[model samples]
Target: MNHPATPQEQDYPLSAVPLEARKSLASMGLVLLGFTFFTATMWAGGSVGTAFDFQTMLLVLLIGNLLLGTYAAILAFIAARTGLNTALMSRFAFGQVGSKLSDFILGFTQIGWYAWGTATMAILLVKMTGLSQAWEMPLMVVFGFGFCISAFIGYRGLEWLSRFAVPAMIILIAVSMTIATNDGGGLAGLSAIVPSEDMSMAAAITLVFGTFVSGGTQATNWTRFARSGKAAVVATLAAFFIGNGLMTLVGAFGALVYQQADIVDILVAQGLATLGILMLFLNLWTTQDNTVYNFAVAGCNMFRTRRRKLVTVVGAGVGTLLAVLGMYEWLIPFLILLGTFIPPVGGVIMANYFVAWRARYPDLETASLPAFNLPGLAAYGLGSLAAYTSPWIAPVVGVVAAALAFALIHVATVAVKERRAEMMKPV
Candidate 1:
């Protein structure tokens, strides 16, 4: 397959992607597809299945995905317009040095997720193959490093894998979904079925939103490669709304019918042993590849180094250790917390890019930025607090609160700067 040339170390963390290196719409779409078609998402679907009636489940999924998709689309637009990854763009709002905080949050979260995915894959492998328990750690290492190498290759590797894996995954997932649907007695039967567990509508929405909010916020990492804004929007919409939505529905379908949320579990229960293994492998690989890539990008930003490949390797090491420690079982609560805190970063980015900078950034190569950006800092803090305390939709509250806080703080800063300039001129 044709690919972009390897990015040199000098250009790894700081520079905008050169226009010539931008990707076509189809390629970007495929990459996003690889990300959204994750086993974790299907697992989240299982959460959906236990909770609500069919109509409620569908409503929750649609509303939740719409929120996730809309948030991601805004980030995608800025990324395409600026050709900057989320970490780089964050420097605009968070300051050159202060951006490290955002980097830490994003990078650390991705590593945690990588660990969770690795653990999940390892256990699933052992279960499916009936391998000895002794092999689980070794399997985790193998899968972790395997996915790590793909990210080490950077965007080109993602493209190659997505090109092959995305299509294959779609077919395999379709088969699973169809089998589950048929077993549950088709569309009519699914609707008529009663829910086994009582899940509040708010909780269901939170489940869907929490599943991908962090990933969605970091979308600029991939969308920055899009050739145009339209491509970025289209790719994000297709992946977050359509691809991620399907994942939730399939999980819900299984839950409502078979009382299973995991697509792998559903597949195994359905007697599609071979297909189950294939889906499990592909699903984990696609998600972990992107997760590692996210970690590498954030690591590069945090350390202010261009050693992306080295960072990728280190991240794999850390994630593998966590997986061996059984992080998968304990990471769900952390992920939900992540959903609340992460959206505020997106809101801050939106305000900084659209309202403050008005879609233009001074040349980052030589542009002067503050040591810190207090407005962004304040907004993020307040947003997090509101999410924790408010009874409303936490993701929405966090995002809207942050955006408004940034805007207000920005206006105040500009006013103060203007007054100082006027006084100096008169004197």
Candidate 2:
């Protein structure tokens, strides 16, 4: 049996959550991840692939599905067993000071994504309402207000939103699929359409990978609530392979069948406007909520404060202001740039959790925060530089470059530390 809590334990208050709550939270994680996959993959696969042919588009889906699913599984396993968010877990690898840098960057970026998502959802709602496109202001107000209300209710409310959003996405996709197949002469016609000559294998791969790179960072947030590492791995793989993979395939198929690259326009053309609006609404909401929640947790951890609710509200407010200013309209270029930065950070975290600090400190599992590790910082910097400089690699080039840089840096650090200790020994 576990020992009674010591003062240290009592003061730190590790997540001694009930089993039921853990299960619920895990379910929420799965749903939220699934919803994110649906939103991002559909948008990318449908719209971005317009320039490509059917075969090239399918290839992109294949590469992205495999890479994201595999990476997420590995990260989820670490998160479930450790029960630590990305920032907290980073201390084991990145040192306390180093972790702060990464977390701050991640938190700020997520804030931008949250605001952008809200605005995009608002725009889609306006379009669906058949109101004048000029109603963007009113739509922005409605979305911002609704998001603030939901954020006020906190994590539990976010979980409820996930539950509703996931099913709504499924139904919308199903309805869209049905409409597309019926209208486009089914799969036979879709298969016959060749893509443009400009479409290449590389572009497809990049598009698919780009869609889920940001999501990889959130693995720890969800996995920490899982019942076990096994559960985390299973949930991550299932959600990505089945949920994400299928959605992208559907989007690709929709693009082929309709010869319409824009996902929103495809829905309108198919007379599935109602379902389209619902998809747009739920997709944006679920992702935005997750982003905001993650940002709040990061803020609370960084400031050593207990103002999660307040911070979330403030973050949401900032995001809303950006949305109203029409920043979301330029989300594509921004996300592309953001994507370049994501892989390196994710690589640093993954290397720290699974390699450098793995079981070296048994007490780490229950520790609230560990001392900052400098090696983690070196690895992150090297990785980021590689991603920024590499021109040939577009979509996932950063992820690969960063992973390699982290592993090399970590090994060198360990070697130097060993040499120093040996030199200082008194024989």
Candidate 3:
């Protein structure tokens, strides 16, 4: 098969890999900087802080976020090098045919998240509006309309939303942290806050790891626009470490200041209900837009359909219906399960681009699509099975299993190919 010409080598490029308007380091930094304040981390940190001392909670938070952030940065670097979305990149690793399985799994997981996010936003809006009873229906309509519009605008709009949301979140977090610190009666106040005996260290660890690893599903999507590998690494590291870390810290402070587990309630108690509403709106908007956009893209890819706006509208409508039905609470367990389900896809992608095809091709822009490889399929299936079966292993087992499976399969394939070539020696 003929190798595709590189972006630098192509004459009249038939496929335009969507080019992101080149952003500055700071703008890119903000985009990557969301990990510090993910809603899940905020919830988990508050929950953990209610039980453990701030120091203990910090230890777990640091370890989990650091490890996950590092892994994400590495994956982002690979994604930047290839300039392919996660699912498209997986095709090379899992074979064009096998990668569809990966796409299906990821698409399903993201759709669930989109539903959960829409539901959460509706609930937040209901609380903000303070309408007693009969608010669910209106909230669902509002959520459906808002989410469909946001998703229809797609990635370009999301990039703009991130720019506005990230700074706003930062400022709100600063305000919330300041208020919480004062309300807690200073750093000395944490000592007086009684810890809950029922909270286990394992649970806290799981919460931290689960929240930090939750973004694994979007690894390639975020990094696809990166101008260079360094850009991707920097963006991922900054987002996870600085952005997500600070958000969790604020949640911990919220727990220490108020005896409540809910961070939003704590903000309301502090007379900052408006700020709380804004933060929730921004958080949900950015995250939900991402979910809907990815769902639309995946849907388009699967059906070879061009109805991006329709897919987004349909997805948002479904999510809104679930919200109206009050399924948000029930969906938490499934979201956690999805957290485990996605990491193996990241592992498989990482193994393919960084290991199996590393030396063979300088870049995806110039390389021929790799042959259909069955070993990659087997590895992904086994890894997914392990993730499904081993609930206690958190994310490591699936990641390791997927990586090893891909590597072993690729090595065996290469060796077989080499032996076949030698047997057909030329005169």
Best by TM-score: 1
Give the Cα error of residue 67 in candidate 3, in Å: 2.0
lDDT of 2: 0.67
Worst 10 residues of 2 by lDDT: 8-17
Clashing pairs in 3: 32-239, 33-239, 35-244, 36-243, 36-244, 36-245, 37-244
Tens-digit lDDT track of model 3 for 300-368: 555545566777787777677766766667543664575576778777877877677772334444556
Stretches of candidate 1 off by over 4 Å are 1-7, 420-427
All candidates' TM-scores? 0.95, 0.87, 0.86
In model 3, the number of clashes is 7
* C-alpha RMSD of each candidate structure in angstroms: 2.7, 3.9, 4.4
lDDT order, best first, reads: 1, 3, 2
lDDT, candidate 3, at 39: 64
Candidate number with greatest lDDT: 1
**What would the TM-score be for candidate 1 when compared with the true structure?**
0.95
Report the number of clashing residue pairs per model. 1, 5, 7
Runs with alpha carbons beyond 4 Å of true place in candidate 3: 1-23, 34-37, 197-203, 212-214, 359-372, 388-393, 420-427
**CA lDDT of each prediction against the hidden true structure:** 0.84, 0.67, 0.67
